[model samples]
Target: MTTARRGRPGYDLESLLQVAVKLFNERGYDGTSMEDLSRKLGITKSAIYHHVPSKEELLRLSVDRALDGLFEVAASTEQLDGRAIDRLEHLVRGSVLVLADRLPFVTLLLRVRGNTKVERSALARRREFDRLVTDLVKQAEAEGDVRPDIDPAVAARLLFGTVNSLIEWYRPRRGSSGAELADAVCKMAFDGLRA
Candidate 1:
């Protein structure tokens, strides 16, 4: 059974999060005030407060949603049995899906500048995620699936850089799909970038 927020009467947490994420991306996190959020949602400021304690909580929730999707991919990859290269491909494709599904939130996450304590904390968590992926890249190199000449750190950065850049070019369309993009990414990354 699901329950709605007490006394809110209509808006639920998920809907509130969607509105909050869109506003956060459009206005920039620091630029957005709680009053601004309430105005955009066409609700009272206190109603907004009823769902989320503060603007910062909204930011934290949005980023956590994106991060949770990403870290789930990494954990699932670790569980699957295969060569490190195969697992790497799984990670890449899963990450693409995460970006596609949570595009707005992840976009906000990647653009964070560490200007506030919340942003700094998000940056630190993002770095930890990067480091975990870097280790996977290193494992792939040891298995001779990746080029030895290129630094694993550099390769990791480049791979994520390309994936992260998808938020810029990838507009969801009716014809082209995320799986198609993920397949292309895997092929391009492994066939072209591999040793």
Candidate 2:
């Protein structure tokens, strides 16, 4: 049995987060003020404060949500134990699902420019995630699974540049399911890179 969370009648953390992400995506974080969130949410600033300590807290939560999802996929036992190429594929597929399921959070995350401490922290996490991908690419190349000519870092960026492009036009309830999209990405990305 679980007790219900107590909060103001209309707005909760989740809803606030949803609106905040939307506004952040639309107006840019620096451009979107607490006033904007309060107005768009049809609530007072103090009401928003009740849910989050500050606007930066909201930014931290949203970006962390996206980063945490990707890191979870990267750290999975399946991802850890596979051949490097296979593990890379698992990482890509799981990342696509993460982007699809948490589209808004991921969008806000990708748009971060390191303008503030929260953005800087998010960028650091992004770099760590990139390092994981680059290491895998190098391992795969060493194993003769990936092409030798390409730099591992370049290959890693290209692979994820493809995955990250999905955020540009992908919309839920469109024709492609996340699994189908992941399969397409894997086929397109791996076929060309595989040696």
Candidate 3:
């Protein structure tokens, strides 16, 4: 006969989500299974389900966490009230900080291939975020803070492409901080684009 099992102490939805996101990052979202999660967590599959109904729900939650951080930066007063170039710098800095702080989630967000409804939704939000940054680039160009030769959309794409690529290789070191990296990115990007 199977013994009655008690829930693990201190194990909650947030903790479960953390493990799920980490596993999803280490193993591709499509590659991980509930059994894998249960094995990693040392819990029964039913216990995993107690926190979230399905693996897809966990994916949605993980990508949403990354998207929420990006949206928060986009909605900040610094991003909205500053000169366009300053605002763009703030957005870039905020994005670097978010990626550093939430590397696993952001990495997963960047890797989503839109195979599922949640992935498609995440992709849509990413596109919307890109459009908002593109608008800032256009405004900066009009104000003569940024060079006019390149199209605003193209500039925005290149800027974000560089920033997003950080996840591939960035590992936090003892003295280095997100703000320092952000400063470097702004300096490099603006040095090239500033008029």
Candidate 4:
């Protein structure tokens, strides 16, 4: 009398987040709707509600996935005993690995424009991460490893901007591994910024 559940399997929160991030990246978060997600998922909007109360909660989860990984790297890299410049390099490499591993989530995070409470919270976290990098850059400058001519905040932005730019063109399956690409980034960026 009973048949097996076949077709598309039930989506867990993780799987739902993955598809949501992909759609958010493709259509921009502001443009995407619960209806669109329900259509794509072959599930009703009420089914999605079973996982999360609202679309904004979904955005918060997706962006938090990215911010959590990034903060983990920043925290671990800070604890390493070495020159500030070396620690910064480690942070960059770890961040690239995060981007490659969670490309879709990071992509969605990068596109956030603070249009909602969730987006504003994400932006606040992003600014906190940027401050961490800026502090490290200032440490490197104080150690005489970084150039004194540039503002540490500017240097931090430029270095991380190069890393973040990967979202525009870098694919996980591209010719280089994340570590390889990170090496190239550090080599090019640090070479120019070093005193």
Clashes of each: 0, 0, 0, 0
Report the C-alpha lDDT of model 2 over 1-195, residue by residue, as the tens digit.
012223435877998898899999999999999989887877788878888999999999999989999999988924377589999999999999999889999999999999999999999999999999999899999989999988899999999999999999989886779998888889899985456
Choose the strongest candidate by TM-score: 4
lDDT of 4 at 124: 97
lDDT of 3 by residue, 1-195 (tens): 012244455468988888888899898999999989887877888877878889999999999999999999999924367589889988998999999989888999999999999999999999999998999999899999999999999999999998999998998898999889888888888885465
**lDDT by residue (tens digit), candidate 1, 1-195:** 022233444678899899889988888888888878767766777877778888888888999888999999989998999888888889999999899889998999998999878889999989998997899899999999898999999999988998999999898889988899998888888788555
Error of 3 at 132 (Å): 0.3
Instruction: Estimate every model's Cα lDDT from 0 to 1.
Output: 0.87, 0.89, 0.89, 0.89
Please give the lDDT score at residue 48 for candidate 1.
77
Better by TM-score, candidate 4 or 1: 4
Off by over 4 Å in 1: 1-9, 193-195
Question: Between 2 and 4, whose TM-score is larger?
Answer: 4
